[model samples]
Target: MRKPQQTPAQATTPYIDALLGYRTRGMVAFHTPGHKLGKGAPPIMREVFGAALLAVDVAMAGGVEDTRESTGLVRRAEDLAAAAWGGERCFFLVNGSTSGIHSLLLGLAGPGDGVILPRNAHKSVQAALIFSGAVPHYVEPTIDPLWGIPLNVPAERVAAAVAAHPESKAVFVVSPSSNGVCAALDAIAGVAHQGGLPLVVDQAWGPHLRFCSRLPLDAMSAGADAMVTSVHKLISGLTQSSAIVARGERLGLQRLESVVKMTQSTSPQALIYASIDAARAQMATQGEQLWSRAVDNAEWLRARLAPLEGVRVLSDEVLGQDGVADLDRTRVTVSAAGLGVTGYELETALRDDYGIAVEAADPLNVLLNVTYGDSHDDVALFAAAMTDLAARRRGARPLHGAALPANWPRFTRQVMTPRDAFFARSEAVPVEHTAGRVSAEMVAPYPPGIPIVAPGEEISDEIAAYLSEAAARAMHVHGPEDLTLKTLRVVS
Candidate 1:
């Protein structure tokens, strides 16, 4: 006798299916959205996004089902994502990776807890430090002398930090720096695991790494305890779409979910959730072909740019050095400083003259992100413009890479916890006189966006001077309320 056919639920896109079902129901509307779908929506919004998009905009409750606990569409979507990413569990984040970082830090570390992390962390990690009340044992990253960009900290450094601070609650590391430099994460993960600690890798720039073998190792396969990634950064997802995946019971899944719930919104955007689900499916199904083309374009650009006079394109040779175990070839970082121009200057000229918009830039290098959407024509135009600019070298001024002066303050004494300093009474004072005083805010140079001085850190004269000079040079200084850098926010 023939066996009965078993019904298998579609695994590719459960959230999207639920959303479509909710949208097609012709039920009378009485929901939180006063817009009542596109009927009550404004003309401009409807015309721009269209009625179809607006119609699917819904609340977590009621429309999908009468109660908060419905068909478990969101949970099923998360399961699909976990399966795709090779995580034991996964949680969808609508507020971006910032919230995921904050949630993980809060879940794993608490007051008086020490966490081993590199100092070149994103501003969000600093904020996580403040939010979680975790004390950080800072490790400096290896600097690339050519571009002056901070790469990953050596695994030995992480091991030393873990060994020195046995009381440390967790270890956090950022691989694949914004400039595409990847750290020795497998070794780092081993060190953390040997110490019986969880490794949290901020993989905001590596969502596509798993989809493409040509890319560097992803955090999940590297044995990270918890990994937070921004799907919108390198994958096909809307802005603010992110996900957190957990592999081990070290950071309890229940605890992570609780913290995530606290950090996320009750009225989360349905469209964002659907987009994440869809993006995951697309990557699982079609990412190999898409990223192969992207890598080809990046390789072509690298070859074309390397032969140009005074242009140094970053290559695989940087691997095998301390803190540099691998590289993401899709990111094209060209050193324009040697061409008698600042990365900022080259960026402006490219945009204004050739209509080519690059990604982040500093004094030394310009970063170009090659995505699957880019066409061959786009690459040709960029190459032609770069070659023309190289031929017309302005002057032979020796390149002064954007390395901070020896006196520049890279580290300041931490007198108080970030949480205390953030909540303490504070007053504004002259930036010059802020030396020896405790800071009440974060001050960072923009392009790289690493905080030079965060709350609870003492403000040194060297740091104040460096920041003041950076402002004068027109490098965008972010995080501080006083953009002019003439005043400093300090603990009263």
Candidate 2:
């Protein structure tokens, strides 16, 4: 893997430096953030976050850069991030990748316009469709029967969708899915461009891909017209920090910027912006070394766990399967089905017994995110915990069920546009009666956050049954009026 070199400008943290300078100036009584530099902060807040953090938790207007006018420091930081990520322009996001996704969809599509996107996209995409009033042409992603998890959407499928819906304003897809399965983005981008549509990637988990050559190709390098990354997911940035990087070839930057600003909070946090800037600088300079270490740590943990009885570590074996063109090695997925335990049970055991919490756990697999922040000691502890768990569960009968039901329903037919159904009068109906009814809310499993039933979609018997089974398994259901799954909201 080639090591990345950052120019002097790329290595500078202009936003962070400016924030620190502002804090050092010791201006009396901040205009907003009633904390007054930690003095007015609650005792518990001061104790938990410390005075230094509160001191710099300043507003965007008078504290860092005036939102009304240009100070150029924040712009410089965003420009450097754009250069680092190989995008024509970049916008730092304080509201996370959700805002970025919203901006992308709203900016690219108008009311009643069509957008082709994978079925396994995040709930934010559905929310964006509702906000933009865009009609969705859903593309089913390849599902791995072994794991019952949704994989990448094939380029051919995208091409077919584009051919079918020639009126689509843009093609959006999620690369390196929540399960670490990456799409053939280069091919997909080509297909979208050939159809005269810009390709937008929801790369929320892959902000580090651009900096590390060892990782899968980033969206920008894969010819995506636009992409959003959550800098905090696998990098050093704080939570809710993200970046929207876009090339203005097809989607105008002015429109994107306007939509982004509209979706974003006017009272944006300075710390989040500074963290994004700092993260970009750090990744541009030392990403190769840091991510190399993280990859090594993940591999070492995988190797250590491979020999454990009944534990299967997923690695490069998933590549070339379905639409998975590459794998993110840092996401270590361990299947504990052979140990006669559900992933939730294994997760509970690890958290309760070993005090180790993984990223997310489904029925058969627990996802462990190993990043630059992890050390050899951390991986060793995890390996040791897995070894102990394996030993304790040895010779147990293997679990016989798949992660998802064999007859799991695909995306149901759209009875109404998401926006129309969302705004239409709706009422709650029994789960069993939901079949054949147009859904007024999204119902999705929480870990992966892909909706099984989106607003305006006709709920089928298979989908209702699958959702009932999922609820019985105690999986967290998101975006529904009733979390118990007893009643579902449908168009009246």
Candidate 3:
């Protein structure tokens, strides 16, 4: 894909320049952040964070611009970001994509409103349902038999869901899942618009998609009404940096901005804002070159690992299967099931033996994310580590009891709205006895963070047993009050 020509204005980082200017003025501190320009900071903090970083951690009010009046520096930066991402409006998020999801849900739907979304959505979407009292109409994503991972939701399923729930306020979906399987966004968006509903995408993992044509189509270009992307995920932004970009008239812009203000912090972190601003400029001017290199490195690693004994690296073979329209080359997903070891075992071996950590690992696959930040040397090191592990484990017997149960529940039966169950009086019950009861909490394996059982769902016996198995494997369970799964929170 040819790189888009960047305008001169895209090169300007207004908010970052303003923040740097403020840091250099040497103004006396009299407001919040008692650290007071690193003077009062402890020696340990100063040593680790350096003086320059500490000095620039200033408040938005009076530091970046006037508190009461609008200087439009931040607004101008957001304009560049929106244009770069093919959105009409963009709002920077300091609390990450989690907050962006919240704002999107709250802005679009109120209590009792129905939202059509995929069952494989991130846990943050479930949280949004709990916060907004929205009713979820789940569209189950196609499960890939080879990797035992959830793929994209088919457009037909979405259209069927929309038809079934005509009163639904909006439609939401996740594209380019954590493992890099992208949904057919254009077809899905067409169905969504034909149903007269706005398409909101949780594109937290595909922030760099718009910059590189080798990647899947971005949300805005696919005709989504609104979408959120985490700049920190696959880009040069600081941690917790994200942006909510929207286009088209289907969504109310004023309400969206109001909800963003409500969900975001009153005193947002200036550093995160500056990083978002600067990252946008970088991607706008140099993203094609940067992501192209990342894609090359990732493909090289995949090619090197594919020939190794008992190892399978996912590539173009996955395309045209399930609902996967395109693949992100920067994400190298490796399955070691043939090596007689689980992905968890492979991840641990790589980390402990080679001092190499991957982005995420499931029972069948380890997802390695290659970004502009990684060099060819970094990719080579990971490839070497994986090759060594595969060679040592060749001809070994398959690990018994390493796989999750085939009957492991993906989406449980929803008995009530998430908000109703979450806010209702609840009690703790033993995991074994909790089957057939209404769950008052959410439980999911971290990294992918898709809930196996969410609030208001009726806990089935199969789900209960799966939780026990997940716990036994020491999978980092997220969102449940009882991390051990010994007890589950259920509605009274």
C-alpha lDDT of all candidate models, in order: 0.82, 0.88, 0.87
**Winner of 2 and 3 under lDDT:** 2
After superposing candidate 1 on the true structure, give the runs of residues whose Cα lies further than 4 Å from its correct spot.
1-11, 66-68, 394-398, 401-409
lDDT of 1: 0.82
Best first by lDDT, ranked = 2, 3, 1
Which regions in candidate 2 have their CA more than 4 angstroms from the true location? 1-5, 402-408
Model 2 per-residue lDDT tens digits across residues 1-492: 453466878789988998898889888854888888789998999999998999888897878755634777778889999999888899989889988999999999988999999999999998998998999998999887667688899999999999999999999999989878899999999999999999999999899998887899889889999999999999988999999999999989999999988998888888999999999999999999899999899888988998888998887778888789999999988888888877788889989999999999887888999999999999999999989888899998888874545333777798899999999999999887788999999987878788989999999888888877766765687999889888889999
Q: Give the Cα error of residue 145 in candidate 1, in Å.
A: 2.7
TM-score of each: 0.93, 0.97, 0.97
Model 2 per-residue lDDT at 218? 86
lDDT per residue for candidate 1 within 183-294, as digits (tens), equals 8889999999999999999998988888776788888888899899999888987899999999765778888889999999988888888889898888777677788899
Q: How well does candidate 2 score on lDDT at residue 389?
A: 86
Better candidate number, 1 or 3, judged by TM-score: 3
Write out the backbone clash pairs for model 3.
none
Residue 400 alpha-carbon offset, candidate 2, angstroms: 1.2
